[model samples]
Target: MGGSFKTQREVNGLFELTDSARNNLKNNAYYNDDLAPTKLDERTWGTYHIAALWVGMSVCIPTYMMASGLMAQGLSWWQAILNIALGNLIVLIPMQLNSHAGTKYGIPYPVFARLSFGIKGAHIASIARAIVAAGWFGIQTWIGGGAINAALSIVSPAWGAWSAGIWVSFFAFWALNVWIAHKGPDAIKFMESWGAPILGVLSLSLMIWAVTAVTQMGGSVGDILNLPATYAPGGFWKIFLPGLTANIAFWATLALNIPDFSRYAKTQKDQFMGQLLGLPTTMAAFAFVGVFVTGATSIVYGEFLWDPVAVVANIGSPIAGLLGALGIAVATLTTNIAANVVAPANGISNLNPQKITYGMGAIITGVFGVVMMPWKLMETAGAYLFDWLGTYGLFLGPLAGMYVADYYIFRKKTLDLDDLFKGEESRYWYKNGINDKAIWTWVIAGIFPVLGKMVPALSFFSDNGWLIGFVVAMIVYPVLMKNDTSSLITPEEEEAMNEKVTG
Candidate 1:
């Protein structure tokens, strides 16, 4: 009798433990307990890292192309410059706020999504974000490959094999990136630290060269400054609003995933200062210099040249052109690794917390980059995909809303951390670890904004999808999930939950 009673108690404990584990898993579906979170080291990064991030982000082909496009839209040069500046300011706010969690928990953005989106739903968002990142990886690779081809042609006329050389160079750089990324976060951080500074110096050098050349040609700096007005229209607000919105969306991926990087910071202050110093100031400086160089190109070349690589090629000096090409390639690679590789890797890792390791995540992400053939996407689709992808802001908006609402409005920012890991019976395991109200709200709210981008009649909302999606999600999520009380967890229950997260 005694033996049988002991056996029964053991069986009961096992069943209860399994049930608890299932609930925890459902609640924290998006996070991976297996991956060790990064602890920030205050000494390693300071204002400079932040500044370099902006330099790397701003001094890219897409940003310049967008600035030029805005100019072509009939806004004056000053108007456009102001627009870019103001736009960057707006993007900085949310980034700073979101980065706090990363610094505190050392978890990436997709993991953070579990606070609001439920575990599984976060994957949906992660996949969307990853798809966009993969596309960008391919596009940047293509651009870098072209630069290699151009440099090779100059070095040896026999290397004039354009298509073959371009693809070859593309694969070479792609392979290098794969290697770097495979080394994990430390490698990515080291590259960002060193590569960012070098790229900044090169960009500044290009600007100086352009200015000096313009002055020697008997042209005043004023002439170059005056060019943007002839191209774009309206004043600061008109240009500023669209430019600001577009840049915010363009930079949204970085802002949203900042936790991925911030998790490495030593303290919240380190993360905060890094964001304040890095994103806004650096982005502004890059924009200023970019506009200055492109303006000089307009005056000297007699036509506007927005692509930095093209600007360097037009300089007519072999050495200078080669240096410029190399700089752009380096800059693009830095971003590809930091922004493109890291976020998606975390996203995929979250999907199967037990099965997908960080190294595996990196490999899978790189493979997707190849399969997507980003070069084909950019060359064939043009800016249409960017516009289409901008619609993602709609989903992000609601997702963010749910996060802020759950933490601040509903749960009061005090999460039952243990419940996050428990299985089905977990208060968080709403309907088999899925939160239908949040998911449905996100889908419905995202549709209109996406349609706005695809349909010409709805293009008016294209540039402002972030705002639109945010507003809709904010209203819809709360209302839909109002009667659903499963998300609520008491303070005492939360404490009894787990003190440490277990894989």
Candidate 2:
């Protein structure tokens, strides 16, 4: 719409194709409507919208439960909040780096992977992220269903007595998520923009309610803050290392697939500033709320209730319980659609872009979510931290390392827009559309962490798997890629190529 190949150009760091390039690639097997590079005019997300996206994602039920899990491990109230805050700051570096490629190229994560992973080989990176995302999708849906079941029990005492009602609510909530994701990206953007403010208000209200209830019971906020550490393993250093690693792994999935959302961002500053302002602050604040409320429960109910749904049910006022459930539902919906649904939907669509639509990929992701049976994954706080988060960290950290090294260090942030979709004709079509070096680099970097999990003497490696994997990839990928300049395009070369495409 803007111009033909003769007049096409870059705007605000974004490289968009002309009508000729679009027409030339439209019918290629690797091309699809969903996977196509976004036009310049399509990049509508401003700083506020990007910030709101993070706010919507960070203020969720699981984030609320994070401090409780950390405290159960060995951290005091202050230590837990500090760890949550610090982990987010560490992850922000990688998050910002990955977001740059998306905003600059207007390509999704799968397409971005093609820079280092090759065309077909990009699947290894995308699907690994998708699997983690699918698991998260199930966990969020389960939390939402729990909220729905809680509200139903309040409305009808008979429903509370029926054990089968929870399963019914689970599928109903699951279907709602799949339907919304099927509607596509605009639906998610609308949900996040509107939901962010409401979620902030809801979180503040819950915190106030917790504080007020505790004060009325003759317990002070100071008392909760001063709570002693319950379970310390050896000492603080032993617990701190793994806890920090697990906290970083909390958002490890999003760090890899961030391009899925950042592709819509208007500029580098918009995405950079928005995430900087949104992610760490919301996470720390919500972690504080979780620690405070769960601590108050020990005083108010004579037992600690880490689950917000259970806490709301025990309030005994039907109206209050219903409102609480609605709040949880909104929080979970905002997080599930953005964080869990988008990555897998785009990643699976990459597998067969011609035949598989974004909507179809979304439905498949939802089915996988149900099959994961996420309830088993949430048995205890310790299990959730050490087993689930730590283990996934081992895999995703190497991915983050490889992506950052390739985009920032090796290629120096330049990509050929037309060659990306050229199939065998594209430079990325390495060795029949697969890059063996990237695949081996990922496997090599991740192996140490996996071994750490098995060997008792190597527990340090397992506990800090995310750090280990990331560092290894950072060192290994460049050495393997040093002599291979096939993918590297200089700025002068890029200008000449542009002229050729225009002529």
Candidate 3:
């Protein structure tokens, strides 16, 4: 939570935003629970637990759908898996870099952004990051609804065909997401820890089922394993390059907002080892399952089945389909709320912390999820794969780059927590309340990418847009803010400031 709105904001030369009494409240931005530093008592998560978080998020329908979409575009199984693995590993660098701020300083991503983007200007990045999360929330909700509809068919075929039934299923799953998020991070952690293993086991079972179905159709296992590429060698790299970029975009949202989760780390080793052990391997392995099953579909059904929900429905037994749908629905639910709802919810709540609680932030995310009309995207999920995921990465990458350069280069891994909360004028206050340099840097870096996305002839910029933006921001921001020492609050001053107020 931030400062209150009832009082007149005081300005005492260099410390208008640092009023101990007036801004003590979490009013101006993020929720008190979200923005504040983690207390010694609440920092109990360890290496395995953090790994479980990634595992739970990684082994879900969207992760599978991404790989399957790549295969649909004509890449072989190895090509698709390689891209996912490589992308995850590349994203891990910035993920770890951003996580350092949270683990060391106990601040969320939005707060961390304030260091580079100014206290208020950070909203630009925060909200931009949230848009992707909102998009994800809608996509996952749509997937869950499809899963629910498939499960419902086992009960009554008529119930599954109604559009009203689909809406009801969507809302019900939406309600489940809201309920868990309302329960807070503890409930989320519990779900991730337990849900990940269950989903992993079920994926193996799904593989077995697919292989059996293919064999029963008199198809050889060798054909599925050695599924030929539909793309010519030259054509494969054309799609593979953008496909790789899309894969990076898959978890790029998390790479930027990771501090939200990393803030809970008990030790630096916990975050480091956990993400290293969990991210790429889980994505590659789960994606392999999707690749194999989709290939099996080609053998058994004479066409590819990219949608996992449809794969479950086509299992040829009502009972088996029901079981698969239930598993998928549960997996999607876990992934949706954990991966999609939490970050944006925190970001919106950060905009006005005093009034908007975490639950309200979550509600905001849910409402936008509906407004995005994710069902339309689902109808041709493959077509939007590059457009939806790769495009967002263009901006998010710059935000991540600025944070890394700001924290490691300009600030030297040090920050004044007291200065982060204030509003008057400090080193972080570049102009009024916004860090114009950081804002301009991000904007300039992202322009061509956004343009490239819109203009077909500039596809080179589109394919490498995120990486280009990241490099430009990384180089530009530090050069612009080189002489600033406003954030250089000494440790003793920090202690005195903390002593005057509550943590």
Top candidate by TM-score: 2
lDDT (tens digit, per residue) of candidate 1 on 201-243: 7767876887798999998778778674653334444444545
Residue 51 in candidate 2, Cα distance off native in Å: 0.9
Error of 1 at 291 (Å): 1.6
lDDT of 2 at 419: 79
Which residue pairs come into collision in candidate 2?
A: none
lDDT (10s digit) by residue, model 2, range 310-329? 88888867898898888888
Better structure of 1 and 3 per lDDT:
3
lDDT of 3 by residue, 258-372 (tens): 9899877888899999999989889999999989988888888888888999899888888888988988888888877889877898888778766777788888888888888
Better of 1 and 3 by TM-score: 3
lDDT measured at residue 114 in model 3 versus the true structure, 0 to 100: 80
Q: Least lDDT summed over 10 consecutive residues: which range in candidate 3?
A: 6-15
lDDT of 2 at 292: 84
Ranking by lDDT: 2, 3, 1
Give all TM-scores, in the order shown.
0.84, 0.95, 0.91
Candidate 1 TM-score versus the reference: 0.84
The 10 consecutive residues of candidate 2 with the worst lDDT sum are 1-10
